[model samples]
Target: MIVGIDLGTTNSAVAIWRDGAASLIPNSLGDVLTPSAVSMTEDGTILVGVAARDRQSTHPALTATAFKRLMGAQKPVMLGRTRFSAEELSALVLRSLKADAEAYLGEPVESAVITVPAYFNDRQRKATRRAGELAGLRVERLLNEPTAAALAHGIHQREDKEPFLVFDLGGGTFDVSIVEIFDGIIEVRASAGDNRLGGEDFNDVMVELVRGQLKGVDALPLSNSELREIMRAAAERTRRGLTEADTAPFSLVWKGREIRRDVRADAFAEAAAGLIARLREPVLRSMRDSGIRTEQLSEVILVGGATRMPIVRRAVTRMFGRFPNASIDPDHAVAMGAAVQAGLKARDSALEEIRLTDVCPFTLGVDTVEFDRLGRMHSGVFCPIIERNTVIPASRVHVFSTVRDNQPVVEFGVYQGEARQVDANVKLGQLSIPVPPRPAGTVRIDCRFSYDVSGLLEVDLTIPETGASKQLVICDDADAPDDAAIAARREVLAALKVHPREDAANAATLARAERCYEAFLGERRDHIGQMIIGFEGVLQKQDPKQIKEARDEIERQLDALEGERFL
Candidate 1:
């Protein structure tokens, strides 16, 4: 069976092509959305999805969520007795989803079309594919998340004659794509986004607000664990509230006092001003690169949960001079698109025969040496192989020669990104073209870069004169640690007495949470003076056991307090 998976940062969902239609497979909880969280049990078993997320309030450290942000990062995180590289952690999540799909279909599932953010660079894209392999599944193709959403939209409106933009703001990333559909073909003219921005930032802002309210009181002593649980729950509530209400109220009792604060819609908007502003450049750049003006785009399709905020909707409308099309649920559209792609892959659907053309989000180049006036070799010259916005499933070639006499090898260090300076871009990897012992500029090495629909790049280096060559599958970087090293690292990580399962980790995570809360309190001391007075009253019961219980109760109140802005 072939399936489509949206392995989101905060949550994930899987869909399959069946009965000539796309269907989503719900997790054990009967919910389509599964939190991208993982929890390890005392027996070394791993629990994924909603179960892991449910444990987060109690076991914050053991439960790893939002690891997607760390994709391509050189660092690995230690969890419990197990240390997991970013790819392994992602595999755990994907494996869980695959299990759910297989059970639903009563058949073994093999290949899949996974969706990724449109702006993911080569390293990140490669990491995603590796994750799929680690999960024991073959990735048929890597579809851009926004492109999938566009496919779903286009399928729904096969008769509509208008160009649309897909604005996807997921849990940990945001991407805006401009797509045009004509004669059953979906062409992505341009795409852009910030991998670091998403719904998590909004929650962090609310968490800070609540921390300030507690800090205003001069007499309250709050534990870090207590503050974090309160803030996390509060941030979640605030995020939900902003979806509908004009004002949301958050109230909590710390020590023996009652604390309350109402976060108005306007305040929520103000808090997210910086994040919202960041979206402008990407949207404008996508449009500008596509050569499509606001007037030319017939509709804007919002995809992802973050777009549910009225503030976001209004900002998009103001920018495009038209309200976005919200007929399709933002959260489900990407998965639906993924399913559609699966159907196409399976060749089992009658949906209009459509071909999608995507582009590399970043530039592809090589690092070369240049001579200075002093005749020193400087190695920062970047010769681009494929420029950004070029059609995908495309390849480009560049020719270079050895600068020194009798140089037996020409080393080409490949890079990705639009930055002119080598330090400003991602050094993907390198390929060395072996040449015969020849004098300066005597050998011609042809370097070719081929990018597929999955956004994976492959480089082929050929010594055309001698017919000697070397090829590299871009996703397979030879220098990256192999499975053995990664496994050894994981074993070492597991033995570090990492924080315990859900509830135990929660305590330590709460401490970190409290530090963040206190920092917020110090910054916003003036606005929450009254709330602080009440917050301290509840914290005076200092018995450890009682404090723990009271802290949980108080955190619930904070959750309610932050829930006001959207609901």
Candidate 2:
């Protein structure tokens, strides 16, 4: 059976089409949601999901999270003694989701449709697909997150044919889409986003607040993850609390003195003014690029958990002059919509007439030189062949000539972005075209960029005079790993041991206890230590029901202990 996976930055979920309807598949713990976290134990045991997340603070060296933001970057995530790329970390999350789906369905699942941010370029999209392949699943399709949300929204709304805007703010990325829904079709007109903006930024706003109020914070370098975790954990808890209350108080032991501060909801708003301003730009840009008036949009839909914030909602309202639709749960819409797409890929009878089309999120262009009035040449100018927001499965061609007289070779630099200068854009790759020793103006080559539905780019350079042509499937970011490198990394992953499925509950419980043991004082800390020992003894008895009951009781105690320690 094929499945739909939302390999999100902070959290992930899986769904499938069953009984002529889409359904979410529960993980081993019988929960529909899973944390996108992975941790490696000192003994070389690999732990994923909740078990891994539990160790993030106490076992920071062995733990890694939020690698999704580094998807196509050249930097590697250094965990303990090993270095891993963002895609490799993502593959671990995918592998866990795959296992959970198979366990629930009681069958082998080999294919999946994954979701990506609309603004992700060709390299980032390829990295996502490569991550899926590393997890042992053939990627059936790469669906845009906002587009998936539109599919889900279009089905529930009673509109026959209407245009709407989708405001998507996830943990690590934000995307906005202007789309039209009609005749069993969801056609996306334009999409825009910043890969680096999201809810996590708001959390950092809270962190900055605490840092300012607390003295001697700078004395402790963040290289100490333990110290950083304590600060961030308190910030995160208080930030989440602001969602429910006007003011939230956070207490933390600092410099041998207890520090207390009340963070107001409005303060977070002011600190994040720049970020909120960013949210406004894409809405206006999408509207302008699509040639759609704000009033013309039938409605505005909100997707992703970050949009649940009152501040974000208000920002959207002020920009579009409408209250965004909240009928869809911001968190679940993307995953659910992915399920619908999965069904479409299977050619499910239910969606026979529905067709979806998407647009390229950014401009594809190359560099050029032009002479000024004074006869001096400027070489940094960008000439776009395919403008941003062009519909996908698109082909565009432009002719470029050699640089100087009797130039032996002509170089074609492939780039993607909206910058007006060549150096300002992201260089995907370059191809050198040989033209038989001709004058600069005499030799010209046709450069065409073909973007497919999956968001991959294929470039073709054709020489008309000699009828010589060359094609390029641009390697991701110029430094992407080859097949041999991937194979070697796979072997390293295979060598590590994964905790047994049956033992996840125990591992999670122990990690939680240790986490609490770090935060509390005296009697409470000793009590948690005792509980861990007791739970370990109970697990050795090989009693499933007994272990579960003990685990639950201890978890409740741990939660209470942590609650009392925090604000």
Candidate 3:
């Protein structure tokens, strides 16, 4: 059976189609949502989800989170003594989710439909697929998060035909999609987004606010990693609190003293004005591309957990002149919709009547040369073969001639974007084809681009005279690992000891206590330090009852000191 996975930046979840409906699969901890965090212990044990997230403040150097923001970048994340690419870190999370699904379903599941931001570029999408492959699952499809939400909301099942907009603001990415549904068809008219904008950026704003308040303090290890983590955690808590209350305290304890600042909702809104402004362009662009005015929209649906913020809700109201739809749970909608898509892929009887048609989020084209009226030739011009928002599984062809007299080879640089100049667009790949030595504009070549339902691109070039042809499939070949390399990395991951699932509560409590120990000083610090020692002694005793009691007591104390986790 194929499961649906939401491999998100802040959290991840899995779901499956069962009992004629899509339902979320609970992990070993009996939670449907899992924090997308990974950590390595000093003894070479790996940890994922909440246990790893708890270690962020205590074992900052060994923990990695929010790596999804760098999905396509060639960056390395260091955890303890090991260095991992973003894909590898994501694979660890995917592997954990796979295990959870298998355990929950009592079957061997190997295929999945993973959700991604609609605005993700080709490289980022490919990286997501690669991450799934690394996790020992065959990635059946990469579904757009917003589109998935539409499916999960059962928009296609409605008898009325109407247009709506999906505003998706997740942990590290933002996307806007214009959709229309009629006659059992859910059509995505347009999609646009910013990969860098999300809830995490708002957290950074809160972090800055707290730092400004503590500027007068001296000799505080503000630059320390653990302290940074502590501040981030505090900011997340305060942000969540501000969702319901008009004012929330952003406080941190250091050197036996508590430094605090009460942040009003207005102040946060003012400080985050820049981020709020960034959400406008994509929304406008999506509407423009879809040729739909605000009045034409039947409803503006909100997706993603970040959309729960009152600040974002207010912004959406002002943009659309209506309260957006929120009946569907923002966090679970995408995963559930993905499961629906998985059912569609499996041709499940319950979903036999539903159909979905997606759009190309960006333009796909090749570099070209243009001659001005004065006969001056200009190169690096982008000639689009497939424009943005075109329905998927589409194929388009364009013809071109040789640019220079007797040019030995015709070079085609494939790019994707809205720029008029090729240099301004993202180059997906390039190829050179040898041609007959002919005068300029004499040799003609046919360029055909095929984009499939799964978002893969194929470029075909043919020369009529020579009957020569070539095809290029867009892929990140330079960074893609071979089978042997993938196997080696898989072996490395499999060889590491994974923390026992049953001991997760104790591990998480201890990790939080360690962080509290690092954040406090003087007597309170001493108290936490002693508690850590006592807890370690209990753990060493290997007595379940004793350990549970000690862990519960520690968690209660930490709750008094730092409050419960924000989630």
Q: List, residue by residue over 230-302, the lDDT tens digit for candidate 2.
A: 6666776787777778898875554444456898889888888899999887877898899999889999999
- Please give the CA lDDT of all the candidate structures: 0.75, 0.82, 0.88
- Deviation (Å) of 552 in candidate 3: 4.8
Off by over 4 Å in 3: 155-161, 218-222, 475-479, 518-534, 543-562
Q: Which regions in candidate 1 have their CA more than 4 angstroms from the true location?
A: 41-45, 160-162, 218-226, 252-259, 371-377, 401-408, 434-444, 462-470, 476-567
TM-scores for every predicted model = 0.80, 0.92, 0.94
- Relative to the true structure, candidate 1 reaches a TM of 0.80
Give the Å shift of residue 198 in candidate 1.
0.1
Candidates 1 and 3 compared: the better one by TM-score is 3
Per-residue C-alpha lDDT of model 3 across residues 455-478, encoded as one tens digit per residue: 778899999999999999874333
How close to the true structure is residue 289 of candidate 2, measured as C-alpha lDDT? Answer: 93
Name the lDDT value of residue 114 in candidate 3: 96
Candidate structures ordered by TM-score, highest first: 3, 2, 1
Model 2 misplacement above 4 A: 216-223, 253-259, 436-440, 474-485, 559-567
Best by lDDT: 3
- Candidate number with the higher TM-score (1 or 2): 2
